[model samples]
Each structure stands twice: as C-alpha cells, then as structure tokens.
Target chain A: MRSVLPVLTIVAFILGFWTLAVVPMNIHLAADQAARGDMVVEPDDARARQEVGAFALALGNPAVIPMTYTLDRPRLPGPQQVVVELWNTVFAVAPTSNRSLIYHGWVTLSATLLGFGMGTALGIALAVGIVFSRTMDLSVMPWAIASQTIPILALAPMIIVVMGALGIQGLLPKAIISAYLSFFPVVVGMVKGLRSPDAMQLDLLRTYSAGPAQGFWKLRLPASVPYLFASLKIGISASLVGAIVGELPTGARAGFGARMLVGDQYGQPLVTWAALFAAAITAAALVGLFAALERVTLKRMGMAA
Target chain B: MVSVDGNPQGLEHSAKTARSAVISASSVDLTFQTNDGPVHALKDVSLDIEKGDFVSFIGPSGCGKTTFLRCIAGLETPTGGALSVNGMTPDEARRARAYGYVFQAAGLYPWRTIGGNVKLPLEIMGYSKAEQEARVRRVLELVDLAGFARKYPWQLSGGMQQRASIARALAFDADILLMDEPFGALDEIVRDHLNEQLLQLWARTEKTIGFVTHSIPEAVYLSTKIVVMSPRPGRIADVIESTLPRERPLDIRDSPEFIAIAHRVRDGLRAGHADD
Candidate 1:
C-alpha cells in the first residue's frame, strides 16, 4: 500500500495536468461549437477564431471553457476522453470487431511475441558462438553492434516491401523487423553474461579438464541467466515498438500502428490517444511479466537476495 | 626429499628422487612477457612431491607458489624445463583427471545448491547417477557438510562455503589435491579450525597434496613438507620436512617442534627478502 501511494500520486498529478492543458488546446474548437449554439462567443467568425491563439480565444469567451472538455474531435483529448474511448474500444465491443482495441492489440502482440522469440534464440546462439570462437567474437560482434545503428523506421518499410515481393504479407515481415530490433540487446547482454566467470572459476574447470561444452552447460550458462533476463526485458519492449513501426509505412491495416494512423487521418484525437495509451500499457505489462519471471527464477536458482 | 642447490650434484640427486615422486619439477621456469619486459615468475624451481605427501608451498605474493601449484595442476605452462605428474606430462595428467584443485575463493555458482556444485566435476567426468550420488554423499560427509548439501552457497558462512568447495573438489576421487590459499580469506579462528579439519581430511584420504599459502603458522601446521619460496625470479629457499606426527591436534601448533618449523619458515622468508 505504501509503494502504491507514490504511483497513484504521480498518476493523479499527470491526469490533473492533462485536464488543465485540454482547455487551451481544445478552446478554439469549443468556441466555434459554442457559437453555433445559443451560447456567447467572442470573435465568432471561424477564420478569426483560427487566427487568434487558443489561450486568447479562451480568455475572450470564458463561457466556452466548460465546453472545451466536451468538444468532438479535440486537438488534445482530455484524460476522461481517452479513458472513455479506451473503455469503449477495449471492452464495449466484441474482440473480433475492427472497432475493438483488443483485436488490434492481438495483431501487434502476436508479431511482437513471435519476433521476440526468434530474436532471443538467435541472440543466445550468436553469443555462444562469439564466446567460444575467436573468429566469431572478432567478426560477428562488430556487425551486431552496427545493426542497431540503422534506424528501424527507415529499415522497416524496406523489409516489408522486400518480403511483400516474396509473397510474405502479414506477420512475418513485422516479426522480422521486431527480431532485428530486439536481437542486439540480447547479444550484447548475453555475451557479457557468458564471460562473467572469473579467472579462478575458469581455472577450476580447466583443472578438471572439462571440455568446452561441459564448461558452457555447467558454468557459463547459469552465470548468464540474470544478464539474459535483463536483456530480455529490453528486447521485448523493443520488439513491441518494432511490431508497431512495421505496421507503419507498410499501411498494414491492423495493429496499434494502423489504429493510430486511422485515428490520425480521420482527426479522431481521442482514438489516437487511446491507442497510444493502450500500447504504453501493453509495453509496461510485458516488462512487468518479465520482471516477475526473473524474480521467481532467480529466487528458485538462489541467485536473488 | 632432495634439496635443489643449483649444482650438478643437486640436479643428479633430484633426478634420482623424481623416479618415486608423484609430482616432479626440475629447473621449471616461467617468464611472463609483459609490455615492460620479461618478468621471470619462476626460475629453476625444482621440487619432488611423493605420493600421500601433504606439501605446502609458503612464500609472499608473487613468489611463484601458486604458479608452481598451477604448473602441477596443468593450469599453467612453464616456459622452460620438464614437469610431470603421475608419470605423464602435466597437460596429459590433467586430461587423465589426476588432481582435484581448490582455489583461493569458494567460487560456488550462486545458481546451484551445495550438492549441485559438488556434483559438477562428477557430472563432467561422466560418473553414473548412482556413483555420483554416492561420491557426493561421501565427500560432503568427509567435509562435514553432509546435511547442508541442499543449502545454497550464499546460505553458508565463508568457512562453510570454502568447506563446500573442498567437498566439490573431492567428489571425483582424484589421487592428487592442489590448493591455492584455500583458507586465505577466512578469519584466524575459522582458519585454524579448517586447518585441523584439512589435516584430518588429508590423513584419511592420503592423497598427494600441494597447498600454497603466505601464513607462517598455517604452512607449519598443515604441511608434512613445507617448501619455503623466494620472490624475484622465484625459487625454493628451503624445504623443511616436518617432525610432527601425523596425528596432529589444534594444540600441536603451540608445541616446540611446530614453533621451530614455523621459525625456520619465517627465517627463510626473511632471507628471501634480504636481497630485495
């Protein structure tokens, strides 16, 4: 309860700030809406309203301040607007409906999970190779580091186009981009983990005349678990971002990215804000799941204090 | 034991002793080439460790005691001269799994229980499931850690963790044991208790043991043969065969013979530093 209070306070603070900011951001639109009604509005012409600053318009027509929060197609949706949209899109409709955020969420989540799995596996394999072989350590590590520097946004469209040409349409292209983004952290982290054993530890194994495979399975692999989990948390979030970005540029007509694009094109700010918040919530949940798994696994392994 | 004096006669004498020795090192030198220049870690270091001998290599840091121990365990290679373990080259003997080595630190894998850590070498050696269990049980009992097998290393104290490490080393039933300052990190009270337990373990096992340490009383109390070493082109300063009986108690360290041996080790260490 003590821990939860701080989080609640911060969340409340953000909501309060958002509620205050909505008045100025949506005031111009509210003024026009109010002017159409029997309510009073200063500089009632729509073009004059556009020319005037939002804060100035709100000051000119104080009666329009209350209507700002209720405006349709608000420039900056209020927190309550986003919350209602989220409730309607996520819970009010069937999951299979195009209007439901759950349907879109599942689309993005499937690609994220698939890509994360592929990326983690490839990263671990590469880390093992780099650790055991001098050639791979020298050759592959530089390339892996270099791969992350290329903007995923720039590369995602190219991957979609290339894969689309090969008749690979829906999830695989997005998953591949997710895999590409997610693998670097795992590679770097797992490499550090695999090499964490000190000189004495390695010497003890050498004294036993333990082979490389035995050394890896017995010592290196166990030592790397904490490191691997740390990377995995970072990797999963990166994978989610990759899945969303992969939806962008390709005009992939589903997932959080598509919802965001649709909301943006149709001028439904509440829809875009709701999708954005849902994506944030999903990323937090994914990371939280890994953190819980890490706690349990490390505790079972006696690594956690 | 034959003393190495850098003479033809001394060389011949060591050659004769090497025949019956379990570990034989003749003029073994190791020069580590750093950016500064060649730093001689060992120089003409000769020693003959017979079967069932509890030998301790005592000296200051950088005196090549641990290096020499590592050479015997095949964890290090001498730049010059021949060293053999069990009638085979050190590397070949290592492959044959001739020795069990205990390092300075406990170095238990935090992810493994005490039993799992002890079972590591046995698993690597491909001992059968039944034999592995039996050996782990036996060795844990030998180290007085029988009941604590399920406990993790972090759950144990430093002394207990080190004891578990010893149990791990002993699980494979090797005929030779190499230790590098195995109790260096412990408190004196715990160190003394472990030293007593180690002597008992050594007596029961009767394995040819090579231990490295800088502590005067520890070297005197634990070793049947103490090789006092000197630094700066590390070489043997003295090799004192203990006159104390095999059945030693903790109080035996206070005896005249034990003090005499410790005095000799102290003197040898001082003499090594005289030239510095």
Candidate 2:
C-alpha cells in the first residue's frame, strides 16, 4: 500500500472529479428546463420550499415546478438517492423481493471466478504445450492472438446461442466466454517467462546431467514467475470483460448486465453508472487478490522483489 | 621404470614419470563445426594426472584451456580419440558425480541463499535432510562462511562468492575437483590468498584437482604438474613438473623455486605460440 499510494491517489482523484463533480454538473444542466411551468433553475426567491426528493429545492409554487428535475437524460443520480436505493435493494430486499444486488453480484462473481479458473488452467496448458513443441508454437500461438481479434462483444451472443443449441446453458456458456477472453495474456506471459533463462544458466543446468523435467522445474519455472504474475493480472481483467460480454447475449435478468438493460430501457442513467462502477470495483478486487497470491508464492520461492 | 618414492627431487627427470595415472588422454581431438569448416580446438594431446595430484592447464586466450577442462568435466564430449577419466567416460563420471566443477564465475544461484546453493548438489543426489544440513554447515565452515550461510549471493563480496562456490564444489565429497579458472576473475591479492588456501585444502583432503588458467604464476604456484597448451589446434607443448612444496605460503610465489617453474611454464607457452 505504501508503494502504491501515489497510484491510488491519482486514480481516486480522477474518479472523484469525474463521478461527483463532472458527471453530476452535466446531468443537472441537461435536466434543467423552464418547460411545463417548471423553473429552469429552481428559484429560491426567499420563498416556497418544495422537498424535491430528499432535498429542499425552492420554487414559486407546488404545481409550477413541474417535471423539469425529472427530465434528466443520461442522468447522474443524486448521491443520497443512490445511497437510499442501494440500501433498500441490497439489505431490505429478501428472497420475497426481486431487487437483490447481493444475488446479482454473487451470480456475476461466480461466473467471473469460474471463467477465470478455467481460462487460467487452459492458458497454462496451452502455454506449456507451445513452449515445449515447435508445432504448437507455429499453430496455436497465432490462433490465440486471432481469438482475441474477433471482437468479444460480437462473439459473446453467438457463443451463448450456440451453447444453448448444444444443450449447454446456465453457468457454462458464460464461464466459457470469460475463459476465452482471459487466456491470451497467460499464454504470452508464460511463454516469454519460460524462455527467460540466460545462456550461462542453461549451460550450468546442462552440466548437472539434468533431464528436461529437472531443467524446466528448476530453472525455467523459477525464471517465469514474474511473467506469470503479470499474465494473471491481465487475465483477471479480461475475465470481467468476459462476464459482462456474456450477460449481453444471455439477457441475464439476475446480474448487473440485466440491470444495465433494464436501466437503458427505463432511461435511468444512474442505475447503469452504478452497475458499471460495481463491475469495475469487482475486477479491481479480483486482480488485487491475484497480486497478493503472487507475492506469497514468489516470496516462498525466494524470487520475490 | 617409475620410482615408488614421492621425493621432491629426481621426480621429473629420473627413471620415469608416475605411471599410476588416473586420467590419461592420448591423441584426443575436439573439432567444433563453424559456419566455415570444422575448427579443431584440441588435437593429438597427451597428458596424465596422477592419483591425488594437482594439475593446471595454462596458456593464452583461445588456447582451448577451458575446452580441455570442459572435456574432462564431461560437459562437452570430445569429437575424436579416446579420453578416459578414472578409467571411465566423462559422461559416466559426471552421472556418478565423481568431480566437482567450479566455473570461471561463481555461478551461485542468485535466488538461493549461500547455504541453499551449497546444498544444491546434496539435493540432486537426494541426501537426507539432516545429512544435507550437516554437510552444508561443515562446508560453510570449511570455506569460513558459516556466518553468511543465510545470506543471498549478491550480498557477498566477489572473494566471498568465489569461496562459496568452492564450498559448493566441496559439498558433494567428489573424488576430483575440476576448476575452470575459478580465481581468474578475482584481483591479484584475492587470487594469491585463494591459491594458498586451495593448496592447503587440497593437501588436507588429498583430492585430485584439474585447474585451467592463463596466469603462469598462478599455474606454477598451485599445480604439482602444469600442462602447457597452445591454440589453433590446441595441444600440449610441455608437461613441466613443479618442484614447489605442497605447503604453499602466499609469499612462496616470490621464492626462487616458484620463479624457476614460472619461467619453465612461460617457455612452454611461448614454444606453442611460435608453432602457430
């Protein structure tokens, strides 16, 4: 935390201005209007106070200040309103109610973790194969790069439909989508790491009468640690992208993606922004967990910085 | 006939050199394939290292000093001729771990602590945990680095690192020690001190040592026999037996006996150069 404090500060500052100041100001301006007997900017002429939702906004008359405040398009929800709704939806809603962010978050997190695990396993297998074989390097490597070029947003829906046709539904299709998007970095990073042994080190290993297994386990694996961690960082972020992409095609009514769809239909911009922020936070947390695991493993190997 | 006595005098010139030789490479050849034709690095070389003897190979750069050492270490198989170490192939010797080799550099694994690096061979040979720790401790003390066992390689000085490497080589309890210019990278002062220490260590253990160096003084100071080699089809020009005593002091390098052997090594190397 001490070393990363500067980066955290810069990120926090940027998000602070963008979320609180820039987003809200634009929303207010866009929402402001004198139409339908409403004041463009609410007039506080030492006068009538109407509690326009959680806040006292001064206006000439009760009916005069019409629907102008509610006219916000691409709106940023007021902080207090979001807070109340979040509390109501998250804590207040039970199995009896449908507005459960916890359930939705769990759904999304499950898919992300499943896909991340599958992707990491497949990525490691492919990387080892490619590293050990010239044929795999010639064939699989290019395909991995090409796999990402096919625009995941476009591919996600097709994958969901195809898996549905194949009688595979529920979590598997989403996990597959997530895995597909998340594995390229693992392969690339691992390949580079596996090849990182210096000539002198290799020669020393040769002198030891060590077989390929011994050589790889002793030298290449140790050398590849930093690269593998680097790949994992990239992989976890891509996993979030996969889960979101999966949601679009599946019309997942229970997760954050489903909420985005509903918000877009109802023209509730704050709900969508809130969902986006939640996903970003989840992804950041996942990567942070990986960072912690990396430190522990590398420290044990005596290769930690 | 070779004499049975191990006297300092009449050892080289008398009836014969010791025939109870452990390593005897005769008409040995090594050719490496280049973009052009094959380049012969070693050819028609013949030499013998007696049991429990210290021999050094010395010459100028590209003299195949290192190549010869590598051949003996079984890291590189010779292209031609018969070469036997302890009456077995170098490959066989290596698999048996008959020799402990120290490279020109320390080559200690940076990721490991000094003790851990020393235990690498013990681990490879699969010693018991208790045995590994005991041997590592003993070797660390042998090299006078018991205090720094827990420290990383980078934390040690060059001289200390070199000593750690020596400890690593000695850890496995191999019969022969093959060192490739192990002290070549050290300063003159450090090299001199290590040479004396190595002589003492060798005398104490009675281990057969094969060392390669380009320094004539270093060769004369440490070796019981010096194999003078030349490049461009590297072969031995002379095998001068050193008359210097086994109990070498650092200042013994300044003695008349050491000076005379140094001159003999210089002459052998110059003769090889003239052939080129």
Candidate 3:
C-alpha cells in the first residue's frame, strides 16, 4: 500500500501537469478556430490578461480548454485523450490489424527476444574466452569496447542497407543489431563475476586437484550467475532499444517503430506516443521477469538474491 | 631418488625411525621474483613429518610458513631443493588426493551450504552419492557442525564457518591435512575452543596435520612439532619437538611443559629478529 500510494500520487501529478500543458500547447489553434467560427468574446479584463496570466484568461472560456483535448493533431495531447487513444488502439482494433498496438508490440517483441537471446549467448561466450585466455583478454576486450564507440544510429543504417542488399529482411537484421548492443554489458559483467572468487577459494580448488572444467562448472560458473543476471537485465533493455532502432531504418510497416514512423509522417502523435509507451512497458516487464528469476536462482545457491 | 640422510637434527632422525613419515622437506627453497626485487620466501627448509604428527609452523607475518605449507599442498612450487608427500612428488600427491587444505579464511563457496561445501571435494574425487553423503556427515560430526550442515556459510559464525572448512578438508579422508592459520580470524575465546576441538579432532582422525599460526600457545598446545620461522628472506629459525603426551586436555595449555615450549618458541622468534 505504501509503495502503491507514492506511484499513484506521482502519476496523478504528471497527468494534472500534462492536462495543463496541453492547454497552452494547443490553445493558439483553439483560439484561431474560435475566431474562425465567429465565437470570439473579448474578456472584460482582456487588457489586464497579459498581467493576470494566460491560464486565468484561458479559464474564462471553458470551451477552449475542452476543445484543446479534442484537437485532430495536438502538439501535446491531454492525458485523457492519450488514455482514450491507448484504449481504442489496444481494444477497438483486431489484434492482427495494422492499426492495433498489440500487433505492433508483438512484432517489436519478437525481434527484441531473438536479439536478446543471441546477444546473451555471444556475451557469455566472449566472457568465458576472455576469462580463460589472457591473449583474448588483452586483445579482444579493448576492441569490444571500441565497437560500442561507433554510434548505433550510424551503424544500424549501414547494417540494414548491407543486409537489405543481400535480401535478408524482417527479424534477422534487427536481432543482429540487438545482439550488437546487448553483448558488451554481458561480457563486462560476466568477466567480473567469473573472477569474483578470491585467491583463497581458487587455491582451495587447486588443493582439490580440480581440472579446469571442474573448476569452471563447480566454481566460476555458479559464481557468475548473479553477474550474468545483472548483465541480462541491461542487455535485454539494450536489445529492445536495438530492435526499435533496427525498425527505424528499413521503412518496415509492421513493428512498433514502423507505427511510430507512420504517426511521425502523418502527424498523428497519439499513435507514436502509444507505441513508445508499449515499448517501455515491455522493457519493464522483461526486467521484472529476469529479476524474479535472479532472486530464485541465487536463493537456491544459498546467496543473497 | 630423494634422500634426507644428511640431517644431523634429532627431529629429522626421529621421523626416519617411525618408517611412516608422510612429508619430507629437505633444503627446500622458494624465491618470489616480485616487481620490487627478489623476495626469498623459504630457504634451506628441512623437516620430516611422521604419519599422524600435528606439526605447526609458527612465525610472524610474511615469514613463509604458509608458503611452505602451500608447497606441501602443491599450491606453490619450491624454486630450490626437494619436497615430497607420501613418497610422491607434491604435484603427483595432490592429484592422488593425498591431503585436504584449510585456509585462514573458511574459503567456503558462499553459494553452497556447509554440507555442499564439504561434498565439493567428494564430488570432484568422483565419490558415489551414498559415499559422499556418508563422508560429509561423518566430517561434519567430527567438527561438531553436524546440525549446521544444511546452513549456508554466511549463516554460521566465523568459528563455525572455519569448522565447516575443516569438515570440508576432512570429508575426503585424505592422509594429510594442511591448515594455514584456519582459526586465526576468530575471537580469542572461539580460537581457544576451536584449538581444543582441533586437537581432539587430530587425535580421533590420526591424519598427519600441518598447521601454520603465529600464536605461540596455539602452536605449543596443538602440535607435536613446532617449526618457528623468521621474516624477510624467510627461513626456519628453529624446530622444537614437544615432549607432551598424545592425550591433551583443554587445561594442558596451563601446564609448565606447555609454557616452557611456548617460551622456546618466543625465544626462537626473538633470536630470528636478533639475527636480522
């Protein structure tokens, strides 16, 4: 209840401020329309309006604030309007329809999941290589860091063009992009986690005459679990961002990013905002799911999850 | 190929008389080449530990006592001279599972319960499931930690965790047990209790135990033989064999013989400093 109260209050405050912001952001259009409809009534305090505040003046015409909420293409849609739009796009359309946020979300989600899986596997493999081999540690790790310095924006389009030229379309390109973004954190995190065992513990393993395989399976691998999960949370989110960016370049017509592109081109900002919110919620859900898994796995290992 | 017949020391000769000497280190030396310079950790270190002997290496910090124990466990290599365990090279003996080692810290895998930590070695040695369980239970009982086997290392007290580490060492039934200041981290009261329990444990198990510590009383009361070491180019200053009987009570620490042995150890430490 205590946690819920703070969240509710914050949401309410944001909505209140959003509603107020929409009036000013859209009031010029409303005023222009009011004038065009021959409904302009100059307030008695019109001369004093400049000093009294624009909000006080806007409050004089109840129709103006309400009209702002109903605009065809509002600059900043009111909270109620966004809520209504969210409800309509989610429930009013068939899930398979192009207009349905569910369909778009599913498309983006598929790419994100695929990319995340590839990224995590690659990251762990690289981490293991780096940990076991000093040459890989000295050579590959710096290169891995250097790879991220090339902005994904510049890289994504090039990848998309290159892959598109080869006639590889849909999920693979996006998954590759996601894999690129997600692998770094996993490598960095897994390296640290695998090395977390101190000198004494390593010596203990030595005394047992444990082979490299046995040491890795019994010590390094289990030791890396908490770190792996931490990286997975970061990697999964980065993968989602990668998926969205991957959608941006291809002029694709299916994913959340594609819907956003349509809304952007058509000036239907509600569609763009809805798609943005859907992506955010999906990322949050993925992180939450992994956190639960981390808790359970670490707890079973007798560690503080 | 390896012979230690030249040593004129009575302690060295007594080990030969037993015909069951488990560890023999003759003129063994280790020099660590660090960034600063060469640091001689052990030099001309000669000793023989008979089977079931409780040998303690007592020295100040950085005195190479732990280094020597590590060499016996095959965790460290001597740069010069010879060391053997159970008539085999340390490395070969290690692979043959000749000994179990307990570090200063409990060194329990935090992810494992005490029982699981104990079972780790058994698992690595390819013990059957039933055998693993039986051995883990037996060792835990020996360490007075039978009830706490299911608990995590963090859940136990420092002393209990150290005991669990000892239990881990004992779990595989190795002939030799190497402990590097296993109870040094605990409070005095706990250390005393663990020392007594360790002596009892040694008496029961009859494992050839090599312990490293700085505490004179601990060295005197727990060991059949004490090797006092000195710092900075570390070397053995003196080796004292206790004349005390095999059966020792907790009150043994208060005995005149125990005090006399402790004084000799202190004098050896002081003399090492004097020689520097």
Candidate number with greatest lDDT: 1
What value does the interface RMSD of model 1 take?
Answer: 0.8
**TM-score of candidate 3's A chain against the true A chain:** 0.91
Q: iRMS of each prediction in angstroms?
A: 0.8, 2.5, 1.3
lDDT of 2 by residue, A195-252 (tens): 8887666766655666777777777887888899999999988988788778877778
Encode model 2's per-residue lDDT on B36-137: one tens digit a residue. Answer: 999989998777777777989998888788898889878788988888888899888787778888888898877789999898778767789999999999
Candidate 1 C-alpha error for residue B113, in Å: 1.3
Between prediction 1 and prediction 2, the one with superior TM-score is 1
Q: How far does residue B212 in candidate 2 sit from its true spot (Å)?
A: 2.3
lDDT score for residue A58 of model 1: 80
Candidate 2 segments exceeding 4 Å error: A1-9, A12-32, A40-72, A75-101, A134-139, B1-18, B268-276
- Give the TM-score ranking, best first: 1, 3, 2
Better of 1 and 3 by lDDT: 1
- Counting clashing residue pairs in each candidate, in order, gives 0, 0, 0
Model 3 stretches with alpha carbons more than 4 Å out: A1-13, A41-63, B1-18
Cα shift from native, residue B103, model 3 (Å): 0.6
Per-candidate DockQ versus the true complex?
0.78, 0.35, 0.67
Candidate 1 lDDT, A123-183, residue by residue in tens: 9999999999999999999999899889988999999999999999999999999999899
